[model samples]
Target: MSHTFSLSRVARLVGVPRSTLQRMVKEGRLTAQNGEVEMEELLRVFPDVKWEDDGEYARVEEIKKKAFAKRIFERALPDKEVLADRLFDLTHEYATAKGLLAHYEQLFEWVMHKLDDVAEAGGAPAAQAVADCKLWLRQQLAAAPREAERARGLLAEERAMRIVSVQVKVLPSGHEFFVEGSDTILEAALRAGIPLNYGCSNGNCGECRARLVAGEVKKVHPHDYVLKEADKAQGAFLMCSYTAVSDIVIEAAVAGAQDIPHQVIATRVKAVELLDERLAALHLTTPRSQRLRFLAGQRVRLKADGVEGEYYLASCPCEDRHLELHVRRDNRPFARRVFDGLRKEDPVTVEGPEGSLVINLDSRRPVIFVAWDDGFAPIKSLVQHAMSLELAEHMHLYWVAADLGHYQDNLCRSWADALDNFTYVPLWVDGGAPEVAARILDDHPDLSHTDLYAAGPAQFLQHLRDGAMARGLSPRGWHAEVLA
Candidate 1:
């Protein structure tokens, strides 16, 4: 029997993005049956993939670590109990395969004995036929197939992946992520940039309650919220408390912009990084027990020293407990405080993550991001979010700066350098908004199959939208936010 792997698992085993596999399938370069690839087919498709050397996999992991701004311990193993359960499952599968092989061997011996009996009863012709059959069987059994070596390597690599990290597929939303190390399902989901609804991440409010649809889960944390008997029978468990022992499917709610509640978190300033004279990046750390939950490209109200202002988030939500915002050197109270005297450990309150401009998580099409001046803040967040999800086929960033002068030029360049599918083009606003829009839109003649997110002044957005629409961009493909 041939083994099969899910598309996501195959991506991991072959050290490529899932989007690459999907593209191959679409282009008819690869065959997938019901979203699974057979081992032979996978080997045939990626003949040159070196299973023993995980260089590509390591590179991807490093990119994800930097993109999400989360520290990933490469050597961290799964929880002890989960590891034991996985080993037990693997052992059971091994035993079953061994038993089947033994049964096949016995059947082969019996057939040989029956053939001998027929040869003795019949004559010289029957004996010769039996001898030929026996020789063929022995020859086949003695010979190793051409794919044997590669198959062994592939299996070994996949087995290691299974023991180290298990994939979790959330129902309804179809979001998938891998639970690595000692991370619970919720932790893994959040780390992957999937906004699953949860309050009190330590399992107190039961807001993260979900039902297991398949596979097994082990409780790694105690929860104060008690489930009713009926609910328990239906496999109800808090996502915050359980870790997956195998590839799992669970029904859970994925939060949208409207679904997330308004939160007021008292965060402490971690640093005030001045990118230039005009712009500063305020780094804040939320309380351990009260992490702020907001989608990428959202704006939040920041309050410090009895003054508050609304600014777009400059950081991805996958960065647990850490939040980043860009403040321009204006007369705004919050911006003034940020540039003048914001110090480490100073209390700053964050509230109302208020904005609808966010990443379209479901889209797998190429994405184009346009930002004007400090609008790069929210655009940066969305880009990092898309990177963490690994859903975009390609990402193009066009930064049009007037006074700020591409403040984070090195970061943008790093993204383009590290990722094959990322492109960065910085433009100067010498000829006004329309000219900048023209320069950006000139590169993308056909926006029919792309999703474009732009943040800038109202005039720039209007000019860009008109040009994008003229170039076959759909109305639904356009997402814009006006920033002064």
Candidate 2:
């Protein structure tokens, strides 16, 4: 055995509490065998301790050290429940019989052999060998029956698996969804039609970030994104890579809207209403068996006559089996067909309703909408949907077009006249001037509390976003749909 001192003795010599030495051991700053601290470890930890050469002190230290060592030896072994007391006593008796008290490894090996023999006799050699080492010791002890019972209890506990379905409550919207032990929160939410924001389904992107407002979740996979310590402290977790461990309440970054689920269906053009010389409202009728279900402000990919393009659904989803797509003449093949060649009864394949530009119908904040030209298609869908939802909040629309005629001023004026919560502002701009953006900023000087939605050309959206941020609106408070 190595020359060692009791931890209490080392602490007494070093003029510190025994708990301090224990703490160092726990922290891996120092090592201890049971309650005994090695002399070399003591010297390594504290080289500054004053040593006394007095005979009386040396005699007392030696006596205390022997007793402490004996006590540690007794306590160092595993409990009788796991390695029964009878086996411990038998080991001692065998060691005494063979005069091999110092040969602990030999005695331990013998005990293991006996356990293997008993396990083999049970006709389960393979299982016995793996679980034998500890059980063998228990079998040699007098409390073998009790120890075996305890072992069974521990084995069952370890074998038990947690596979319960957990309830996940989303904040702000109070939307509840279930996440099975196998599925992630994001996957479950998406399946449940809870529009949670997500970029990469794989954990690399941090787009699915949410706060664990209450309860626990376990990371199901490694993420390429490095989560900040501050964010972790605030209970932030990537929803794509985490599964709920218990019933949880999470505050997701995205809002939850009770909109219809998305669908892909075949439809025929009911009529082509030319609202203006440049704008064609193509009304498509879905088969009664499969009507497209979509939220307002969401776009659908329409494939017709060898051309496939995305267009926003202009009519409210309440108008089942009927779809209205506002197509403007941009000289694109799809636009040309809609304005000139496309006729009634033409077959149209509508796919999707993707995009997360829907309203936070629950938010009580005032809403501001900015749309330019044909971008008003989705904005019109949104306004009508909001009115249908009876959103009791104030709403303002700022429609910008090249001229008064292109602004769709009549439709906006009608809404303004009918809805008490709606306001309309028609802005005429040539090629999106900086003054038009400045005028919007001038109108809403403090946009801090407003939920602003902007849909236009990329440059126009960027300008409005930059101007709004500079004016006081948070980036989180700004939502955009850039028409390319």
User: Which model scores highest in TM-score?
Assistant: 1
Model 2, 1-484: lDDT tens per residue?
A: 4456555345445554343455567678888986567656766675544443223234333433331221111112222221333244445655785676457667877877776677667777665564756765656764656434543433232122112344677887755565643567886665444557766667887988999998777777679998999999999999988877655789985444333445678899888888888788888988854656577788989988898788998776545466788887787778877876788899989988787677765655678888888888888777765544333256899988853245357767766655445789988895455777887878898988788877788877877888999888987778889887
Give the TM-score (vs. native) of candidate 2: 0.47
| lDDT (Cα, tens digit) per residue for candidate 1, span 202-314 | 87899999999999999999999989999999999999999999999999999889988999999999989888888888989988878899999999999999999999999
Q: Candidate 1 at 239: error in angstroms?
A: 0.8
Error of model 2, residue 111, in angstroms: 95
- The most accurate candidate by lDDT is 1
- Which ranges of candidate 2 are over 4 A from the true structure? 1-262, 430-432
Distance from true position, residue 236, model 1, in Å? Answer: 1.9
- Candidate 1 residues lying further than 4 Å off, grouped into runs, are 69-75
